[model samples]
Target: MKASIALQILPLSHSADRLQVIEKVIAYLQKQPVNQVVTPFETVLEGEWEELMLILKTAIELAGSEADNIFANVKINYGQILSIEEKIEKYHS
Candidate 1:
């Protein structure tokens, strides 16, 4: 089954520039095999839960490396497409 997740990442220190950090994140996501990952904006990632988690983890790691003062605020929500709602409901139940 495929699900969508949303993430919000922000850098933490005053000395850390937001634009530069965002740029690094954009570059990293662009290189991934998954073609639709978005950055500096809301993104809806479609993949298995485990695969999405790995992608998120990698994003955090890459962002962290860009600056010592960097930090990420991530929020993820999971839901299947309407066509698969029945399957999702069955899994949840």
Candidate 2:
């Protein structure tokens, strides 16, 4: 993997179960090989750029299917030799 992507998906559901939809997406992401961090506003994933793109597509589709509307906020950091662990390891004891 040569790149990392942080994807924050917000599903606008007419129903009150919006969090449920987000949780479903998180569960799906958890199954992938990408290193992932779930935060209050986004989920950061690190892995191959191509693989991450594919996963993004799947995540969007899954969220769309589960909600009436969806918004995805994506941030990518690339072109350097790094990994998710490298970026956050220092913060961990």
Which number leads on lDDT? 2
Q: Give candidate 2's whole-model lDDT.
A: 0.85
lDDT of 1 by residue, 1-93 (tens): 565566566777576787788777767666765525464564445567677788888878877876677656665546645433443468767
Worst 10 contiguous positions by lDDT, candidate 1: 80-89
lDDT of each model, Cα atoms only?
A: 0.65, 0.85
Error of 2 at 22 (Å): 0.3
Model 2 lDDT, residue 25, Cα: 90
User: Model 1 TM-score?
Assistant: 0.65
Tens digits of per-residue lDDT for model 2, 43-77: 88887889989999999999999988988889988
User: Which RMSD does model 2 reach against the true structure?
Assistant: 1.6
Off by over 4 Å in 1: 35-40, 82-93
Per-model root-mean-square deviation over C-alphas: 7.0, 1.6
CA shift of 35, model 2, Å: 1.7
